[model samples]
Target: MSNTPLVQMIGIEKHFGGVRAVDHVSLDLYPGEVVGVLGHNGAGKSCLMRILAGAMLPNEGEIRVGGKTVTFADPNDAREAGIETIYQTLALADHLDAPSNLFLGRELKTRFGNLDDARMLEESRKVLARLNPNFKNLSDPVSSLSGGQRQVIAIARAIYFDTRVLIMDEPTAALGPSETAMVSDLIRQLRSEGIGILLVSHDMHDVFDLCDRVVVMNKGRLVGAHGIDEVTKDDVLSLIVKGELPADWSARNLEAAQ
Candidate 1:
């Protein structure tokens, strides 16, 4: 991972009328690293990520990409800024084939001004090969594919362009063990390629296994951040359940400050 943050959300706050969905949260994602964002339901983790992904607007905050401030009016704005988000839904066109879904909004055009099936399929093949070599159902509708195959389609779409930062929400949520392993391997591959990743997952084991660091949130506030090697599963669970960092974690943070 690079020393400079690929994306930074500082002092982010959001509210729905009288309810505070997010509150003064800050996070940093660095190149070639996966940072897991963990929190219980209604803890504002989704709201924070939505703001980062440009699906929702933050009431107060500054977002910096490559150390320069940026604003996301909508999801398209975020995408154009090289930020891609793969939600839990995968947001795929189930009736369409893998190649069609990969180029749903941004299809290639031939010289005569027609949908270029050959070009799309060829490009899809390249992206899919890099992400999932075992995927061979190019012509089959995504609905006919398995959970992991569908995920590969979504991820391929996000990464087809100049993707700098990727946000994955519960990537392995609906997958079986084998499918989950595939997604895990894909995540590592993307990280190795220098794509900053923010992984939003409720699965403790997934976060511990795949993330270089973890950020815990509670009641819309950031409770703590921990290195994977420095904190145990129990330490993270305590923060999620109680919004309190373990004593050892606190001591470590204090010592680092000193």
Candidate 2:
């Protein structure tokens, strides 16, 4: 992994009237690393990610991409900065085919200002093949594809544009065992390609299996961040449920204090 982070969110804060949706949160995502964000429904993990994805603005914070401080007025700005977000919905047009959906808003056009369907299809095929070799339904509407296959389309769309940072929200939420495994393999493949990923999930198994590090949040506060080897599932669970560090970590802090 690179010593420098591909993306850094520093001291992020968001408020909704009297409620603190997010509170002074700082997080980093390094190239070729998968960092899992864990939290309950309102723990602010989603809120923080939305800020990074440019879906929401932070009341107090700054974001850095590729080591340069930047501002994102909208999601398009974030995408221009090489950040892409795959929401839980996958956000595909059910009626559109893979190629059409891949080039939805940013369609390829011919010299005369016509839709370059052939070129878009060819490019979509190549990206999908890279992500999933068995994805052969290029002409099929996305609604007809399976869950894992739909995920491939979503991912291919994101990475096809040279995405350096990917934020996946509950990637395997409703996937079956086999489909989930397929998504897991795709994530590993992306990591090997040096793409930094922020995986927001509630599944402990997925976190332990796919993430190099995990950050836990509760009641809009980050309670703990730990490397996979430095903590157990129970440790992470405790942090999520009670907002407390593991006993061993507490012991180490006590020793350091002395």
Candidate 3:
């Protein structure tokens, strides 16, 4: 594996009318590492990730994957580049079964041009078994599944497509404790598989427990980046609320300031 990051968003900027939603934000994610993005509601973390996911374009910035600069014209371009985003909605068809939902737009077909249901189901089983061993209701409509099960399906779909960079937005927002733990375990599994993850979440517990690093933003500006061992929950909250670097982070920059 090379030292280059799996994905890099440099100097990203997004403006809406008179407001700069994201200003000169830069982030890097590496394989097998989960970097949690934290910010208040309007702090601009979502805007930056959206640009990286190809959901929205930035006014100024460049995205590089595998050390090659590329421009994403749309989400399809991002997916083709091995980037998969699992939004909070999960984006599944309620009436469809697991296999049908997994192969929603990109269905596999047989030589005769018919849908390859057997192959699709087999692949779905393999992926789901790896992600969620308890997910035995593959033939049931997603509407009948629990919140955690649905999340497993969403994640299984992403990994099934050979996803390299996975962006998960508020994955456990609506889950109970057990479901949250289930999703957290799946995230750890994905990280162990050498997938680069950009996790956007407001849950401090999730960030502290799951991420290797935390990147904070405030009012469209990058506040600071801290390794998991470098900051505490209070330190992160201070940064998010007041845009202040942690005391230790400030200490590291004292000589540079002088």
- lDDT (CA) for every model shown? 0.90, 0.90, 0.88
Q: Which parts of model 3 are misplaced by more than 4 Å?
A: 246-258
Q: How close is candidate 2 to the true structure, as a TM-score?
A: 0.91
- Range of the 10 consecutive residues with the lowest summed lDDT in candidate 2: 249-258
Off by over 4 Å in 2: 252-258
Model 3, 6-58: lDDT tens digits are 99999999999989999999989999999999999889987887788888989
In order of appearance, the predictions have TM-scores of: 0.91, 0.91, 0.90
Q: What number of backbone clashes does candidate 3 have, counting pairs of residues 3 or more apart or in separate chains?
A: 0
Clashes of each: 0, 0, 0
Identify the superior model by lDDT, candidate 1 or candidate 3.
1
- Model 1 lDDT tens row, 1-258: 668999999999999998888989989999999999999989999899889989999999999999999999989889988899898899998899999999987789999989999999999999999877798999998999988789889988988989989999998888888878878998898899999999999999899999999999999899988788878899999999999977687687677678
lDDT of 2 at 114: 100
Q: Which is superior by TM-score, 2 or 3? A: 2
Top candidate by lDDT: 1
Task: Tell me the lDDT of model 3 at 65.
Answer: 93
Alpha-carbon deviation at 257 in model 1, angstroms: 12
